[model samples]
Target: MRYLYSLLLLCSIVLWSSCRNDFETEPSTGNLQFSRDTVYLDTVFSNIGSSTYNLKVYNRSDDDITIPTIQLAGGESSNYRLNVDGLPGKSFENIDILAKDSIFVFIETTANIENFSNENQFLLTDAIEFDTGANQQKVELVTLIQDAVFLYPEKFDDGTTESLSFGFDEEGNEILIEGFFLDETELTFTNEKPYVIYGYAAVPGNRTLNIEAGARVHFHEASGIIVAQDGSLHVNGMLSNDQETLENEVIFESDRLEPDFSEIPGQWGAIWLTAGSTNNLINYATIKNATVGILTESNDGTSNPTLTINNSKIYNSSNAGLLARTGHVKGNNLVIGSAGQSSLSLSLGGQYNFTNCTFANYWTGSYRSLPTVLVQNYLETPEQIFVSDLIEANFNNCIIYGNENRELVLNERSEADFNARFENCLIRYNDFGFGSQGYDFDDETLFPGTIINVIPNFYNPQENEFMIDEESGANNLANPSTATNQDILGTPRGSSPDSGAYESIIFPEED
Candidate 1:
């Protein structure tokens, strides 16, 4: 009788389980859907301030959702919390969210997103719940991905250690750059390879460079380097020309789209050599597309290192050709353009020595400040009117030319010492009276012994835009005694040299 009772109990249990499975009911509900799949928040914030962003949430479910109360997941204060309660956070009151409704969620952070850590995850308040039948409940959302961070290039403290492998993107571009930094370390780019930058690049702090020779670099209209004060650059490599590469090479790397000249203006920033740097050298390279070109400033009133440029080309910039605050610079083949602003203007404190250089202003209209060897450099526009002061300096074996024969005016009060000279150089000007002022003579004055009859260089003058007509006084000033002080490479205008940037280079006459 006991065995029979056990068997009956087992059968009863199995029968009840089968009946429950067959009679179970399914909940009637719609699939959950979000109003938008992605949200983008783009902003530029400094490290001194805080900002907030909001995300909206919508529910497409058929049942109602209840949110008791919203609060930060962690026990952190409201300063870093996304969801805040009206009063204290201990409230357990549930909020009934209707169908197809939306609610906004907030995310707050201190000034500068860089303060946030990588491990922190965004969380919503769970003080609310939803009934099974609630339709289209809404919730505010936050992004799971973090912001981009900057990583600087590695260098040794004592110039003995090797840098760790720096990572690059798929296109082989460097990532994570601090726009400004201050360090004494020197980074070397040794491989004699060509590098193309597709994005922005910067060297913010003081940097020492040991770049190898024959290294080709391209600053894709998007890249530039700015070195802050107390930082100096030593470039031993060559910067290749984009025009040369596009014309001769045929390499397929990525999308082959034509360059959009209109999209990028002053496509790249100038190489800013801040006030503290010294002893910078630029040799054998072509630098282009910069607005201000190469600028050096010494605000603290200390004469630092000398900027030496030998056998190089500086051309095609949009602003004042070369800007120098205070330094001793030696330039050769130093082609400066007055196309945008005045070409090669120096601040009141700058000291310059130029040689075998070309200063070309190939425009017709009058620029506010004509390019002059001045002690100061200022910003200019097409509508402004001004003449720069020709302060103390030497222009030897150099070419000075402007468009439509417009001459570079030398202000009456400015001083040009005897050492300041222009030799064997052409000075072309649009206004005949103003062009010969640099020679301390006029077009009507002429010497039979020094005169050489030649047609006016209406097209391209030998040097820059300034030229000499046979009957003009410029003829007698052709070979001045000032030319003697210049070096073989034409520099350091000695005592009583002519007033321009060229020393005679005796070349064999062509057959």
Candidate 2:
């Protein structure tokens, strides 16, 4: 009888589970409906500048939404502008006319438009959520604004260092410099000339420069920085009066203005380190005022060169700080300043390492992907920075901080080997903690990846010990030998061990 009763109880439990009525019913949200979950624009223009093709936005749910404030991405806000007045509280608007209710958005800038580049980007935000026109609850919205085809003047030179300065006219035409290489091989420029690059300054042959550390390089008319397969930049540092060597500090700025806020790509390009590029080292440098900062990679990934960046700072560039393709990149002390519009972008699919690095993203206005490993880096619009799905990389002894809206996003399939460890670090942003991993993909996909492997015990900033979060590997990484010897400020952090790119400096205790 006892056995029969037990079997009956088991059967009852199964039957109850199978019945929908046996479980509590979730409250129906029938009134809520979204016009669209997301929207895209082929091109957009602000009072300052324009954007390139591929702009996108995210709708938090299936509900109506509105945008409150908007700004251009990168530093090109002087040419074009965005018109946000006609946009309904729940309706969206752009310069282009797209088929209503469709996900596809297409817009382009005119040739008459000014201050627009091929790399211009824009970001839009909506603070509060509201209901659709109906009785439904409103959904949140996030959008990327940009335009298609930010064109630049097509004039380039491949010769020895000369007094070359190029720029754009008031009508936005290319201004070329016709001169021979100077005897000193030093290209000096005056602010009177405003040159822009339609493409990039491609150094094909071997090149060397002895530039002043604080020299300003205004890339007003260059698409980006491309070191050809055979190119080489042996930027030797300068020795300061206090024994500080000359740091190669290159500032990238543009002529784009505000109102339309029109600046895009092809206005200023990225710095590409190609194959056969030898010993490209930069120290005590600051790379800012352009589209993308310093990048080391080949589009096909066959090039495997080495570059070292020590005691450097990269800030205010349009997108990432330091982007490494399939190569070897090492830095002793590096600081990456963030614009808060975008996080410090890193595509580490190669052998990359850092001794002491600091990444700061204090701005919390828009939502951006924090630096970590991720898959599917696709930015169809101005605000998005795409992650090239197939790459291997790591970040060590680094300090990563951001605001509440931003976060570090690591996809499920990406695997970062041991060299990708974040030892003695502090990462705090948004509603998330420093180190945690989640199951983002399932077995159905070819790649199953995770976001991070953090060692929580090591994250104690007060104790100055940091450990990468792992299922069980925290103990091994916490060894004292792994502590970074220096800080971003170029000071000794002490052997006692601190986390990330900073060390704790404790004075001697008084007796």
Tell me the lDDT of model 2 at 287: 60
lDDT for each residue of candidate 2 in 1-511, tens digit (9 for 90 to 100): 9999999999998988788543232222223234454333223233323342222333434333333223332113222223233332223422222222213222223222233344435454332222223323432323344332222333347643222344687689766442222223333222222224344555544553333454444455545545545455543333233423233343344444322333232335566676555556676655654556777763423343367777666655555666654456676657665542343444434555665565554433244445422222332346654433434344554555543333455442233332234444444424345565533222223211212233233333222222222332222222246545555445565544444444443333468
Instruction: Give the TM-score of each candidate.
Output: 0.44, 0.44
Per-residue alpha-carbon lDDT of model 1 for 1-511, expressed as tens digits? 9999999999999999887744232232324343344322222222211234555545556555555444443334322335422233322245444566655554443333334444322222221212234542333333232222222343458863223223687799765542323233425544433443333234444456544565444443434455555545666644334434432121111111123332122545566666666567776544555666677765334453457765454444566557775445767555564446656666533456665565666533235455433433222457663333333355554556555344344333233221234444555544346535433423332111122222223223322323222333222243444333443233454443332333333233468
**lDDT of candidate model 1 versus the reference:** 0.44
lDDT of residue 361 for candidate 2: 48
Candidate 1 Cα outliers beyond 4 Å, as residue runs: 1-178, 182-186, 195-207, 220-223, 237-265, 299-305, 363-369, 372-391, 411-424, 430-439, 442-511
Best by lDDT: 1
